[model samples]
Target: MAATNQGGPSLLTRTTLIVVAVILVVFAFHALYVYTSERSEIIDDIELDVAESLKRLSKSLGPFIESYAVNEYESLVTTEAALKRHFAVIVEDFEMGEILGQPYYLFGQLRQGDGQYVDVQARDTSITEQLDQAFYAGSAPIIGSSGKVLGEVWVYASDDILVKKLDRALLEELFTVLVLAGILSLLLTAVLRRYFFNSILGIDAALKNSDQEGIPKAPVPSFRYRELAVLSNGINTMLDSIKGSRENLKIERRRLRNTIIGTRSGIWEWNVQTGETVFNERWAEILGYSLEELAPISIETWMTLAHPEDLQRSSELLDKHFRGELDYYECEARMRHKNGHWVWILDRGSVQSWDEHGRPLVMYGTHQDITERKQAEASLSMAAGVFRHAREGIVLTSAGGTILDVNSAFCTLTGYARSEAVNQNYEFMLASDHHNRDFRKQVLSSLENEGVWSGECWIPCRNGSVFPTLMTIAAVSNNDNEIEHYVTLFADISHLKQNEEQLRQIAHYDALTGLPNRLLLSERLRHAVSTTRRHGDVLAVVFMDLDGFKAINDTYGHASGDELLIVLARRMQTTLRECDTVARLGGDEFVVLLPELSSGTDCKPILTRLLAALSAPVDLAGHSVHVSASLGVTLYPQAQDIDADILLRQADIAMYQAKQRGKNQVRFFNGMDGSAFNSRLVPPASSDQSEKQLD
Candidate 1:
């Protein structure tokens, strides 16, 4: 019974509030409508009142005023009387003198009551609301007949009786407003209690009592009573579940971001329709930009970072990918790395996500640094090629002397094909077998200790013929200096041996007479002089110079002179036996190397044969030219002990002494035997030579 009674009051309060609000609203609307109608009527009434007053005033003064004004009023009294009559309607509020003192007559007026005039001096008073306004409160014009408007008529009036009644009716709405305010408050409280407040209370209760997971979900609403509450609770539960799911999704996304960025892998997403792209921070950085540098990415950003050489390739690949022809987008190309250097990367990518139409929406990829590995492989390939194709015989051996690698040059050098030489030991191929046993042990031991052995050795070829070779062997090592292999650069030196002998012959032997030159002569002289000094046997060095050879050269050319010199060198070489050495000093000069002379007189036969040999007429270049040589004989042992140069100098002086004696001659030096003999130099002059020249 008590609950029922309480419910009744609550219901009654709610019903009363609604009823009061409707009644207040009805009254307010009615008041506003009535006020609006009354205001318009008041305005119309003021206008009509002003018009009526003006009509009455005009009627009162129109006839006389118009008649006098039309006559132009020559008389003051006539004009004054007419003006006085016109001002009568507006003269009531002013004194008679003041009214008559106004500037001009009044014909237009709205107030016709009690001789109230208007417009007495051309003052505009066309509108008058004060006379008939319901709420009029303003000043009005007070015209007098004094020809001067003395004052303004101030009127304070209330709205007409009907308007006052309307205003009074509006004022009377206070009791209804109070009733409406209380009722609205009650209604608002009831609605809040039923919907918002009750729902909020339920939520609070659930929050307090529910488990940590969330508020326990309530059952679905079926009835009207608290249906909104049930629905709100259901929405809250759904929102909690959604929030949890969203948070889990956020964590997963963060984990994915960490994986990609930690690996320095770039991720991208593209919208086909809009041609918009999104790339992660590291991905942008890989292209030499920060996340902020390129965002809301477009084709322009990709194009800017892409290598110019790869532009067309990337475009074609993209076109093909969009056509569903390729499943993967993988490429190993150099993308410009950060700081504008090209980096070799393995750019492997896959279509991570796609739209319903099979269009690529997102791509995930990775870049791997493989530049070192690539370079090492290329280096190895080049090394192999050079070793196999080199012109020099390059052989690679194991540290144990097993030949592991050999080039074409090696095959050609040994006259053995590559296959025949492969597994052979390097020591077995050497032809210097007499020294091999000891040499091998030393070389192998040295190579083991020092990692290198390089020297000259004899090696046998394919035909079993032996040849000398210059070989350089070096051990290629790692960082630790452990021998990885041995490289032997060797070449056959057979041609070099023959060349060496030829060079020796050219250096020591004269080409003209096939006799020893000054070099061989000096060498033999040293030995001969050493022997004579030890054995007490005397040695002689005879130096000879050709006399009158210039006459032969001038008569015939250098050819005849060379032939004569050749003959002279040969005869001197023949004059001395094998024990003696004869060599050309140069030109027409010669030196003899004599050893084991019995006496100083033994040089006498050598000198006689040399002179007899030069006496023969020599045929040179088909031209016979008479040539003779001046001989200087110097005995060694007798001339104390002088070196080769001083000995040759003595021989040269003795020869000059001989030339001073006459034409062709020989001179020998004596031990202080200054047999002063002047070389009666006969000049090719004196008119006597002119007769001999003619003869």
Candidate 2:
């Protein structure tokens, strides 16, 4: 082979002589081709040329128009100026054309007739696309007092100008081709006579005389024709093609390297020769190493960063791949991050190619960032675990009150475990037997709109024990306004409920005998009066005052009186039916409100039984205390539309009448019913009764 080229031509005087001759011929052909192709194209560009020429002409004319407008001339075509001071604005830019005459194409500055000479309307815009056929509106549109629209101008460039331009281009191209061909033909004959003929003949003689080397033919041929020029040019072009191919190969390699690095995945290259490894900074950073450590880097160093649990398996996979038993190695394992924590990575490596001898040479690969994926999976698992081990009663339902998720605490609270509650409607726990239906609707409302709600609810336990609970329900929603779940947290309030009921009873009843006290009795009295008034029913208020109970307390002490009160309270309780209201009005006083009565006649029997019970007395702490009460009765709705207070007072006054007749007698409050006259309800002293009473 004639010294086959590897990268570039060797520096030799003989080769230099030949290359110069070839370059001269190539330039000759290049000039020839340029002349041949561009001649007609330049000729065809006449229209564009005219437009450009016009633009230059218009630019030169701009200053004169500006000056005429500034002088405020009434007519610029008719006016001449010394224009010495204003010479600067009037100076020609050369490209601007002279203003043409009347009936102009665009802005007409010239008046068509006489006095109607158009005031100048010189345009501010340069190269207005609006004027394809050129036009001029004169200087009036320009500034200053003398400015006037002088005249208008318009014209299309003639086709004759374009034809003349084409003719000139053809002459120039012919001149260029002739000049190029004559210079090339003369230079080639001289170089061929001086260089390739003598150079090749001398090289052949030297090679033949040395006689030690193989029989080699000369690359340059013996020639006098232009074929030698063609041949040399062809060889130079071939050399150029090789140079381009090598440059393209280098570019491809650079692009491949960049693509690997830019992918954000950690790229790595294993060089089996030097036992040195090159890794992308990302790869090293991902594995807790710096790029500066590359020279000292090895696969062994990387293995140390793998998680202990995963290291052995990763090693095994690598071993198998290296032994040629496997084509690739892949495993998910933890690699320490630059921050020193192990992050999970999917390590994959492929056998991209082998060397000529079939020996493993280079491996190219990358590691992907999977930290987020791993964390998301772990978060999901953790959430599931928390749900499994939760302690507070948690029941997650749909917005519609259907149970979706339940925890052990919920089961413990509702006496239903996860297995039983998950598939059932949450309303099942509402205890349809006890809780109102309207409350369930409220719970639904809270879950759908407010995202939270809480109140007392009677939830049925598994054993059918219904309990009141302070429940808080929350709505879970996504980014969109759609409800995902309803979470209910309930704290058992059964004890509070029981205690509250006991408190209610203690508030209204006398703790000593479990009988209605004054507060409850007054309430009942009012209710009785209202009912009697509304229904035309008869109701009575009977008041009784214990006569001897204080004496019993005075002798046996208050302890014994309290006991006596209890005994008498029980006796009075049995004296009347459940429909009647009896209340202890402090001290030794008691009152009864009887409803649904026919009249005071109905209360009469009740009063008689009460008095007998009180008179019978009871044994208290070994002392039999003889206790009697003065009883009085009053009718409702018969006198003055009697309210609770008036009826009770009247009954009390009647009781005083009984006291006057000596204790234990039951009296009816009709009128004339006071014994001590201290009762506010006492009827006015009878004229026949009081005057005689005083006497």
- C-alpha lDDT score of every prediction, in listed order: 0.63, 0.63
Give per-residue CA lDDT, model 1, range 1-695, as digits (tens).
01112233444356556766776677678667766776677667655554444444333333324333423321322333234332222322233223468444433233343544333323332233323432443334433344434333322233344456657756665556666767776776677667555555554454444334543444333334566657765766685686578689989998986887788776666565566777777676666678786765785776776678776776677677767787776665566766778755565566677789777776656656555776787789988898878877888878677888789988888798888777888776654654557887877777778877788777777888777788777888899877788888887887998899899989998887677788888888888878888998878777778777777788888877877777777777677787888887677788876778888777666666766677666767566656666667677786466776767777778788877766356666654763323222222232111111100
**How many backbone clashes does every candidate have?**
25, 33
- Model 2 scores worst on lDDT over the 10 consecutive residues at 81-90
Q: Model 2: how far is 168 from its true place, Å?
A: 99
Q: Which ten residues in a row have the lowest lDDT in candidate 1?
A: 686-695
After the best TM-score superposition of candidate 2, give how far the Cα of residue 641 lies from its true spot, in angstroms: 1.1
